[model samples]
Target: MPISSLARSITGAGRRFPPPLARDPHAGCAKPDRNLPPDRTASVIHKPHILVVFGTRPEAIKMAPVVAALRARDGLDVSVAVTAQHRQLLDQVLAIFGIVPDVDLDLMQAGQSLDTLAARILTQFGATLDARRPDRILVHGDTLTSMVATLAAYFRQIPVGHVEAGLRSGNIYSPWPEEANRKVTGVIADLHFAPTPQAAAALRAENVPGAAIHVTGNTVIDALLAMRDRIAAQPALAAGLDPLAARFAGRRIVAVTSHRRENFGDGMAQVAAAIARIADRPDVGVIFPVHPNPAVRPVMEAALGSHPNVALIDPLDYPHFVRLMAMSVVMLTDSGGVQEEAPSLGKPVLVMRDTTERPEGVAAGTSQLVGTDPDTIVNRMFALLDDDAAYAAMAQAHNPYGDGQAAQRIARIVDDAHRR
Candidate 1:
């Protein structure tokens, strides 16, 4: 079978997947109902309202599965809200998932500062929360939008359910405001849906009540698996990737994605330099979905643009990216979600960051942190390319991030909590 068809078979779209086992390694919380509905006695009461909020493309990709799961349940009334922090990118994911946000704050500006963005999100989102008056608010990952939106919900006294929660890099400034954003959300959120046992342990160490934290796995896998299936079933969904697929035919393709704010200056230059060196190999082809940010685009294009084997194209939509991942030999990224998703596709990932909050990937042997050092990046890339055993080890490692049933588990947990 072709690679795309094989991916479809693995995903098993339109069929129900088995739920993740309700075993919590942290030993603080009770086993949640695996597939049970809300308590029958509480059915007479009104269905709980869940307002799902996200802004950036990554958040939308991770949160879309949770929103779909909540919408599928009978016990929950689900609504979506987007801050549009990354307007075009966010909309692309929303369209892929067919999610129509109940509110769009349109918070993006040409050259907005962090302080200004935070203030706008807090103000606009606060009013939206007041008007909608949802029973609970759900935020995904760590963006300025997630942090400020959680604060808005807190001010309204509405409980916040944080998806992909409990990630910590220890150093608050390493990932810039992301570490602080998730930490702030962690401190304020009422219900935390941690992606791994390690993440849950981090929450426990911080004195968060065990009952409030549930190991639901990461929702990014759910979104990834779904998109892979869709792209496979309908090849047209992957049209954006066809040119690269044809261009790199019979060659080892390395998919590259690096756009973290911290990797702006010297870090980006080093990454570009590394890619230039990697592209010199005749057998390898590099497909980089260059971020449009002024900090990244100019540096990357200047460094790698003239290279025939290096294709630095515009950012792709969800389906297109999934297709690229499905076809690639390996992935090089600074993206947290990519670290998690690539392992599931049995693709080895070389992380470009110095530190990562998703240590579960590294511990599981599915990914390695190469940082932004040009030598480090190039050496790691060559090892994966030249050493068959090294590549297989990382590709075949267990994906600790998820099993694609995270959204279902989160929906069931939310239903059970709302009834109480």
Candidate 2:
């Protein structure tokens, strides 16, 4: 079937699934099977049900590996539910990963506030939990979807397994609601999959039981390495990047991505100005995939759109984005996942945020925080462009994220928990 048709079919079929809880949550946790042997052993040998939930693009990217891993197990029944908080972007990642969510909340609405989004997710997901009643629900990262989904499951008395938990920026408002979202999920999740030792320690400091936390390296690396390999083998997958590759030719490509809500107005303009200035160098070229947000697109286009060497294009798909990172000499971004991903490809990163929750990249010397100050961003971009030694230092540093076996570790952990 055509991709577009398949997507429509999935969306249409999703709505036909039983609406959230037509019955009580605890009324019938399990359905009887008349064909099964009438013995205690047979009754006890039922497969465990695991429901994995996520809403946005980042959550889908990080959770795709876990979903795949869980599905590969023999005694587990896995289902996926997507809130589609970011309808188009979320669908892009799902298509790339070939994930068709069993339940599509379709919760996105124009100009919706955080309170409304949270209320809708809780109500709709609460019904989903009652209908599915899986043994456990797994949520990923720090989105509002993750937090409220956990709350919904908790209300139904179902356990939540948090992936990429235990990250703290020490300030609640710096990263806005994300820092608080992750903290709340940490409080409620039964299993915490910390991406690094530091994250695991953070959870321990919160007085969370050490036994519940597992340091399963960031699944982003697993997704990155896998995508990189697939792109390498099937070059057509990265055909979208071919045009930019031809356009930049011999120039050093500086790939940029900045759309953090914290950097909305002034911060965004400064970063755009820096990119415009950095493009003045004849030997360097800038390829920025402009975010679609009104606050972001206008500033970026007004500032860098006229630069001859800068190409301000729409957002690239996952494989194209990975291909862009692989082809680039450096990356500048305020994204959390990029900090973890770019390092694996040996690309030096200059963070556009003042403080990062994923400081593992900074400590390992793979990424440096330059904030949104145009002067600082310009100076750092120049140093990486002009000074080979400085660029090499960051490019050659170790990626502290993972060794690409995170999904296996997470799958084993979940299986062991179920067996116990």
Candidate 3:
């Protein structure tokens, strides 16, 4: 569906879909005696309202599939709310997925600190909860936005369902605030949609009741598969990468993404140094979608801006990014989504972190952990670039993240819970 049409369908403006069919509350029960009394004859049916909330690009991307699934089902009224923490980046995913958020907090501001953003999301979303009065609120993963949004819902005693829950890195500060944010959400979230057996096990270890945890696959794979198919049919959707592909036609391309807070000053510089070493090769070229954060963009540009074989460009949109992944020889990123996504495309991911919450990929042989050490990164890059056997071993391994039906499972679970 087009963005406008989807928005209209969500808001009941144009009504592209047919009205929901009336459901009988007592479908399987025996018919009541209408002649004796009318009170027993009539049945009351109530549709539970669910509010889905997210903020930032990753949250938006992961939640897009869930929104589509929930909206397509009957007996549930689903509404989307975006905190817009990463304003421009969040909107890009929203457009690609054709999701029209029923309530947009528009909370992003110049140089907004963490505490300020949290305060705004809590205050504004508290008001939203009061006005919308949804029966439950669904939150995704661990962003400051997710944690704060979950808190807002908790304040009102509204039940919250957490998607991609039960990720733990042991040390909360290593992945910075994310590890802590997810753990906090795990405490308040009544319905835990864990992506892997490992994640479910982690939740159980924490004493989160086993009944609340559902082992649905990660939704990123669902989004990735859907977009991959879309691009396959409509090649023009990702045509923006033609020039970059042409520039490095004869050489193998390495797609890179890094913007972790742990890898800020020294870590980011070393990463640029590693890329510089790899780009020095005559047979290799690097395509890095430099993040726009002041802490990151300039550091990378200073180290690699003038390199002939390096294309340090702005972030590509969804389809274009998918195209980058499809054509690239190896995936290099610190992104949690990339770890799950690259393996689906048969791309070996060299995770740029010492520890990862998604350890299934490492144990499954789809990826390897090569932290921010310049020497280690260079060695790993060269190993994959020079040897086919090493590359194939990682590429051929199974992607344990998902099979592309997570959103459907999540929608069904939510619908069933609401029916109760």
Candidate 4:
């Protein structure tokens, strides 16, 4: 799909899309055979049902590996449900991973308030639970979907598993509800699949039982490694970047992305200014995939749209984004997933937020926090772009995240959780 049409497919804006994967009533699990004896059918129906739920693009990316891992196991039935908090972007990842959501809430509105979105997920997902009756459900990260889904599962007395749990920025409102979201999930989740040791420790500090906490490295690395290998084998999978590679042949490319709600107006403006200033250098080119959010796209376009060296394009599919990260000298973003992903590719990430729940990167010399202040963003990014020594220090391909087996570990843990 062309980039323009990809953006509009979520809204049906001037584009006709074949419907997404059809909803399957039995989901990834099999329907019990009615022809068989009643005793045998009951046994088949009791084969532990695991439901994987997520809403946004990041959640989809991280959970895809877990879903794949679970499906590969014997005697375990896995189903996927996407609430689609971020409609088209989430679809892009699902297509890349070949994930067919058993239930798509289809709950995105043009301009819905957080309270409204939460209410819809709570009620709709509650209905899905009533029908699916999963043995245990898995939710990823700190989205509102995960939080309310956990609440719904708790009300129904179903066990919940949290992937990428135990991250804390110390200040709840700094990440603007995400910090709170993850903490609340940690409280309710019987299985906490933390991405790092620090994250596991945070959960312990919160009085969570250590037995429940397992440091399964971030699944983003699993997803990243898998795509990176695919791009390596075929190379055509990531051919979307061929044009950009030709456009900025000799110049150093700086891949950029930002869509954090905290950095809406002024914060976005600062990031744009920094990009424009970086683009001023003839040797450096900025390739920013402008986010489709109303608050983000306008600010960035108004500030840096006319810049000659900058390519402000629509968001790329998973392989293209990974290809961009592999091609870039440095990554600039406020995305939590990027913080974990870029490092595995040996790309130093300059975060645009004041605080990050994933602080493992900073301590591991893989990423740096350079808030949204244009000066800070520019100066910090320049250090990596200009100084080879500085760049090499942060460019260590040693990822503290994971070794691409997180999903397997998570699958094993989930299997154990139900076996008991």
User: TM-score per candidate, in order?
Assistant: 0.89, 0.91, 0.90, 0.92
Q: For model 4, state the Cα shift of residue 337 in Å.
A: 0.7
lDDT of 1 by residue, 1-420 (tens): 111222221211001113212322222211234455677434423456778989999999999989888888877767888999999788888887889888888989978999999999999998877666777788998999999998887777678888998999898987888999999999988788999999999999998888889999999999998888887789887775666778899899999998898988889899999999999999999888877788988898888878888887777788878888888999999998899999999999999998999999999999999999999999999999999999999999999998999999999998988776
Error of 1 at 147 (Å): 0.5
lDDT of 3 by residue, 1-420 (tens): 111111112110001112223334333222344574555344322456778999888888788999999888866767888889888788888988888888898998978888898899999998888777677789999899889988887777777899999888898886988998999888988899999999999999998888899999999999999999999998888877777789899999999999999999999999999999999999988998887798998898889988887888777778878889999999989999999999999999999999999999999999999999999999998998889999999999999999999999999998997766
lDDT of 3 at 230: 96
lDDT of each: 0.84, 0.85, 0.85, 0.86
Task: Give the candidate number with the greatest TM-score.
Answer: 4
Tens digits of per-residue lDDT, candidate 2, 1-420, equal 111121122221001112122333233233445566787434334666788999998898899999999989866768899999898888888988999888999999977889999999999988888777777888998999999998887777677888998999998986988998999888888889999999999999998888888999999999999999998898888776666688889999999999898999889989988888889999888888776778898888777777889887777778888888999999999999999999999999999999999999999999999999999999988998889999999999999999999988999998888886
Give the C-alpha lDDT of model 3: 0.85
Which is better, 3 or 4, measured by TM-score?
4
Error of 1 at 116 (Å): 0.4
Which parts of model 2 are misplaced by more than 4 Å? 1-45
Task: Please report the candidate that would top lDDT against the real structure.
Answer: 4
What is the lDDT for 66 in model 4?
96
Query: TM-score for model 4?
Result: 0.92
Which pairs of residues collide in model 4? none
